[model samples]
Target: MKAVYINELGGTDVLTHGDRPEPEISPGEVLLRVHASALNHLDLNLRASNCRRFPHILGCDLAGEVVQISPDAGTDLKVGDRVLVDNRVKCGGINLCEHCASGNDQWCARQQRIGVDRDGGHADYVVAPAINAYTIPDAMPFTEAAALPIAAHTAWHCLITQAQLQPWDDVLVQAAGSGVGSMGIQIAKMMGCRVITTAGSDWKLDEAKKLGADAVINYRETASISQAVREMTDGKGVDVVFDCVGADVWEENMLCLKPQGRLVITGVTSGSRSSIDLSILQGRPLHLIGSGGRSRRSMADVMKMVNQGALHGIVGRTFPMAGVAEAHQAMHDRDFFGKLVIEH
Candidate 1:
C-alpha cells in the first residue's frame, strides 16, 4: 500500500511518500481502505516530536470503507461499509474497560491517539478497532466525513460538554480560522448563542462570519481584542470563551470573559507557557476547563446533526495523499481555514 510516513522526526523533509506493507487486522480489528484523511495540528507536532517507532503514519481523521473484518470482531459491519474511524483508541479490546464502558474512553489510562501513539490513516490501507469505526450516511462525501472525527468532536466536547454553553449566551471563540474554532463558532450559533470569533486576517474573519460568527475580530488590526470584545458586548464580556490559542491569548481570554464565565481550552497551538494573574481569578471567579478528545457518544451526536444538515463540514483544502508534505506546510503557515484533507 502507498503511504505517507516519517522515518525520522523533523520537518516535512522527513515525510516519505512511498509503498509500505498493508496492515493486517488483529482480533476485534478490521482492515479499512482509507479513502480520505484529514490533517490536524497534532500531525505537525507528532512529525517533529520523538516517537517510539520510525516509519510512522500521521493522520487521525479518516473516512474509509471496510474491506476485511477479523473473525473475532463482534460487529454488524461487513466489507464495503463506509465508516469514519474514531481517532481515540480505548485501553481494553472489544471488551470495554470501565472508562470506555461509561463513554469516557478519553480518560482510559492505556488509551492512545490513532496517529500519535499508533500508525494512523495516512495511507491507502489501515487497521482500526471495530468499535472505533462509525458508519456514515451514504449521502456524505468521504472528504467531509474525513473532516469530522477530530475537530468537530473536539468542538462539541469543549463547548457543549465542558463549557455548558447556553442558548442566547454571548460566546467568544479564539482562532476562528482553525478547525476547532470554526466548528465552535458554528456549534455555538446552532445552539442559539451569539458567537464572536477572532482571526488574524480580514479574509478569515469574513469567512468566519459566513460560518455563523455574529462578530469577527481581526487580531492583527486590533491592538486590544479584549477591549474590542467588551465594546461589542456593551461592556459585559462573553459568557463563555473557547480558546485554544494558549499563552498568546491567555490574558486576553481572561479579559474577554464575563464574571463567573467559563473558558474551555482544548489546545495550545500558540505555545503553552503562560503566566496567570491570580488577582483576576479572585475578582471574577472564572472557570477554567481543559479538554481533549470527546467520547464516542459525543461524536455520534455531532455526526447525527451533521447527517441531518444542522452542522456543515468545514473542509478548506484537499491534497492528494502524496501531497501530504505540502498540506503539512500549509497548516504550519496557517494558510487555510477549517480542515485540510488528504485524499487517498
Candidate 2:
C-alpha cells in the first residue's frame, strides 16, 4: 500500500510518500479502499508534535469504497459501498465503557481517533470500525464527501447541538475562510439566520457571501470588529457567535455578542491563553461554550442533511496522493478557502 507517513516530528520536511504495509481489519471492522482524504489543522500539529508514533499517517477525514467487511461487523454496509468515515472510534462494549452505554460515546474514556491515535486514510487503504462508516449520497464525488465528516460535523455539533442556534438568531462566524467556518456560514443560512462572517482576506469574505453570509468583514482591515458587527446589527450585537479562532478574537467576540448570546468555540488556531475581564461576564451574562468531543449521532444528523441536499462539502483544492507534503505546506500557510483534499 502507498501512503504518506512521518518518521519524526518536525516541519513538512518530515512527511514521506512511499509504500507501507496495508492494514488488516479486525472483528467488527471493515477495510476501505480510500478514494479521497481531506486535510485539517490537526494534520499540521500532528506533523510537529513529539508524541506521535514513528511512521504515523495523517488524515482524519476520508471517503472511500468498502472493499471488505468482517462478518461480525453488524452493519448494513456492504462491499463496494461508497462511504464517508467518522474518525472517532469509541470502546464498543456497554459493560466496558459507561460512556458508550449512556450514548455519549464521544466522551468514552477509551476513545481513539483515526489519524491521531492510529494510522488513518492518507493511503490506498485503511481499516475502520464499520459503525464509523456512513454511506454518502450517490451523486456526491469522493473528494467532496471526504471534506464533510470533520468540518461539517463539527459545525453541526457546535451550532445545532451545543449552541442551540435558532433560525431567527443573528449569527457571527469567525474565520470565514476555514473549513469549519465556511460550513458554519452555510449551516447558519440554512436555518434562516442572518449571518455576519469575518476573514483576514477580502476574497475569503466574498466567498462567505456566496455561502449566504448576509455580511462579511475583513478583520485585517477593520479597526474594530465588534463595532462593525454592532453597526451591522443595528447596535444590538449578534445573538450567537461561532468562533474557531481563539485568544486573538476573544475580547472582540465577547463584545460582539448580545447580552445573553451564545459563543461556541470549536478551535483555537490562534494561541489559546488569554485573560478575560471577569466584569464582562458579570454585567452581560453570556453562554460560553467549548466544543468538546463530537457525538456519532451528530455525524449522523449531518449526513442526513447532506443526503437531503440541505448541505454540501466545500472543496477548496485537490492534491494527488503524492502531493501530501505540498498539501501540508498549503494548509500551514492557510492558502485555501475550504477543505484541501488528497485524491487517491
Candidate 3:
C-alpha cells in the first residue's frame, strides 16, 4: 500500500509518500480501500509533534469502499460498500464505557483519534472499527464525502449542538473561507437564520455568499468587525457568533454579539492566548463556549444531514496522494476556502 506518512515530527520535508505494508484488521474492524481523504489543521499539528506511532498516516477525513470485515465485527457492512470513517474510536460496542452508556461518549476517557493516536487515512488502505464507519449515499462522490468527517462535523457540533442556533437568530460566522466556517454558514442558513460571515479576501467572501451568507465582510479591510455586524443587524448585533479563528478576533467576536448571545469557538488558527475583560461578561451576560470533545452521535447527526441533502461537503481543492506534501503547504498558506482532499 502507498501512503503519506511521517517518521519524525517536522515540516513538510518529513512527509514521505511511499509503500508500506497493508494494514490487517482485527476483530470488530473493517479494512477499507481508500478512495479519498481530506486534510485538516490537525494533520499539520500532528505532523509537527511527537506521534504514538512512527510512519504515522496523516489524514483525518476518509471515504472508501469496504474490502474486508472481521468475522466478529457483527456489522451490517459488506464488501464494496461505500463508507466514511468517524475518526473517533472506543465510543461504542457491547461493553459501553460509563460515558457511552450515558450518551456522553464524547467524554469517554479511553477514546483515541485515528489520525492522531493511530494510523489514519491518506493511503490506499486503512482499517477502522466497523462502528466508526458510516455508509455514504451512492450518489456522493468520494472527494466530497472525504471532506465531511472533520470539517462538517466540527461545524455542526459548534453551531447546532453547542451554540443551539435558532431560525430567527442573526448569526455571525468568523473566517468564512475556512472549512468549518463555510459549513457553519450552510447549517445556519438551512435553519432559516440570517448569516453574516467574514473572510480576509474578497473572493472568499464572494464564495461565502454562494453558501447562503446574508452578508460578507472583508475583515482585513474592515475598520471594526463589530460595527459592521451591528450595521447589518440594525444595530442589534448577531444572536450567535461562530468562530474558528481565535485570540486575534476574540474581542471582536464578543463585540459582534447581542446581549445574551452565544459565541462558540472550535479552532485557534491564529495564536490562542488572550485575556477577556471580566466586566464585559458581567455586563452582557453572554455565552462563551469552548468546543471540547466531539462525539460519534454528533458525527452521526452530521451524516443524517448529508444524506438528506440538507448539507454538503465543501471541497476547495483536490490533490493526488503523492502530492500530500504540496497539500500540507497549501493548508499552511491558508490558500483554500474549504477542504483540501487527497485522492488515492
Best model per lDDT: 2
lDDT of 1: 0.89
lDDT of 1 by residue, 229-302 (tens): 99999999999999989999999999999998899999899999999988999899899999965777787788
What local distance difference test score does each model get? Answer: 0.89, 0.92, 0.91
Give TM per candidate: 0.96, 0.98, 0.98
Model 1 compared with the native: what TM-score?
Answer: 0.96
Q: What does the lDDT read for residue 230 in candidate 2?
A: 98
Please write out the lDDT profile of model 3 over residues 1-344, one tens digit for every residue: 89999999899999999988999998899999999999998888888875668978888889999999999999999999999999988854678889888889888878998888888898899999999999999999999999888888888888888999889999999988888998999999999999999999999999999998889999889999999999998899999999989999999999998999999999999989999887888889799998988888788888898999988888999999889999999999998888899988
Would you list the rank order by TM-score, best first? 2, 3, 1
Cα RMSDs, all models: 1.5, 1.0, 1.1
Task: State the lDDT at 3 in candidate 1.
Answer: 89
Give candidate 1 regions above 4 Å deviation.
92-98, 101-103
lDDT of 2 at 133: 96
At residue 307, what lDDT does model 2 achieve? 95
lDDT: which is higher, 1 or 2? 2
lDDT of 2 by residue, 159-243 (tens): 9999998999999999999999999999999999999999999888888888999998998899999999999998999999999
Model 1 poorest ten-residue lDDT run: 91-100
